[model samples]
Target: ISLIKKEIETFISSYNKSLQQKDKNIKISDIKIQKNTLSLNINSQGIFRPHNALLQLKNSISKEFGKKHKLGVREIKINNYDIQFDLEKKPLKNVTIPFADVKFKEKQATISLNNIDEEFLQKNYIDRMINLVNEKVENQYYEGKGEFWKLIWESGEKKPIWTKDPTEEMTKLDWLKQGPTKGKWFFRPQATAILKTMEKIAVEEVLKPLRFQEIIESNLVPFDIWLKTGHLEGMPGEFYYISEPATRDVEKWERFVDLIKITKEVPLEELEKNISTPAAGICYAQCPVIYWSFKGKTISEKSLPVLVYDNTAVSGRYESGGRHGIERVDEFHR
Candidate 1:
């Protein structure tokens, strides 16, 4: 069965040969497998067919093996990449009922792959190519400027009943002459971080249709991309992400502008230790900065707040054709 899936991939690649002839430069990369399933996305392809092409491949597998299976479901966005699949295996003896032989009911699609002969469709439809590629699509978007989202500060200050042991001995000094530079700690409530974080990588959706589509579309793989911006307590929401991208990876940034490259993942601990301590010999405690480390990504303050470091990751793919995506540990994490 695994071999069949791989073959389905080879078959799809072979099938896509005609796409290039049409002057369509569709590219597919990234291949993944999970128990009884496989998935990927699409990028750069003029035609969106990962979901559709794979189903045909799956249907072919079903016909040759006398097995019953069905197509998977998918969600497509601007790039048109999505998730798609087939039904689980079951015994043919269950065909005794009217809706008996149906292997699975995915998204309300009554699909039967293996036993339904193509010859039958031709016999009934008068030589017409009878294939049903169906999917439901919805458009949901948020309003913003050039950057999909924005982060702004609100008037959230530290609660009057502050809890964390804070410093407060108003040091009366001539430094007040510097005005804003004086140590005036305005207890800030967690302000929203603007699309502060992003993870790059080769397109994972490459696996989505690679197993079944003759022509894999999409040259880029995008997953769990994180976007954080500044926000205030009671102000109009400051930040929102179109997609809940996973954690960030440092390796991916070693080279941006490239998307097809692959990189090895390092332990969150190793990533943390690699930080080249203050080239200027300054710590957050001494410079009115923020110092913290958790999960993997670390933020060491200097003049401005910076990520400084990140650890958890999957594969860092980028859009530049060489490197991409951040290293992600879990679909959601630090």
Candidate 2:
């Protein structure tokens, strides 16, 4: 019994080390040992499904004791009482991923200002041009990119009858590197009585921080931000981009900081049964460990998207079935 206990201790030590390496918040809190029965308790910062962890434990026990008890006579009970994830927001830094879009509007209103002795007409025309420019800019933002047009007025006037230098807010054009145009101009004279302006800048910035916030908040997509460790069974984003063979390969992981929709949870039991299938292969090992049981019960699920199995992504683990998790030391007790 002592030898078996020592063996178990060694294995436990290694297992605990791997879990720690993954930064899994779970820890071995209690252990009950006996001749044929053993129970291990762990605390974690929440899991997608507690039962998945239970199943992994079950498999580990069976695999460990299979040499002597092929029938899988070992039982396991893993409890996660109060697990909380430290999902605090980080500092805001500039990112090149174009998370936001910028739209700038420029207006150039030009009139001959010749043979016209009226100021209201000129003012009205300039105002109208400004409105036109604003309209064009707003439309472009919604309708994609277009020419950053300009309207210039020229006449017999020595200085080419001009209105107040319209463009006041000179947005460092370079700042908007992705902008459609850096400049545009048009020159004409009908002697309407209005004047022209050099440049009038109107810009709008749209930033999408919680891209997935709308879906979750409106319940349009049933998804949650898992700041801890676990798996997301089903997400609506899966259907957006389908894959060959099945949906597993097509499914994309929308992480804790992603925006997604919760469609349903994938049947983990079915996945376990068919570990060799292509779909399973895609979704398998999604996390270092899966949470399946909540207080020792099961729930009917449909789909899953995000999985938190590993805090660190290893180069290659699938080809070895986590053999890296095991180390055989030269120590035998018989």
Q: Which one wins on TM-score? A: 2
Q: TM-scores of the models, in the given order?
A: 0.19, 0.23
Off by over 4 Å in 1: 3-6, 18-23, 47-51, 54-334
Query: Per-residue lDDT for 241-291 in model 2, tens only?
Result: 112332343232222112223426564443444233322112222222233
Task: Please report how far candidate 1 places residue 271 from its true position, in Å.
Answer: 62
Task: Estimate every model's Cα lDDT from 0 to 1.
Answer: 0.31, 0.34
lDDT for 98 (candidate 2): 17
Model 2 weakest lDDT span, ten residues long: 213-222
> Tens digits of per-residue lDDT for model 1 on 165-283?
22222223211121131221222222112112221211224332343212212211222112111111121231211222132566643443132244454444443444433212111
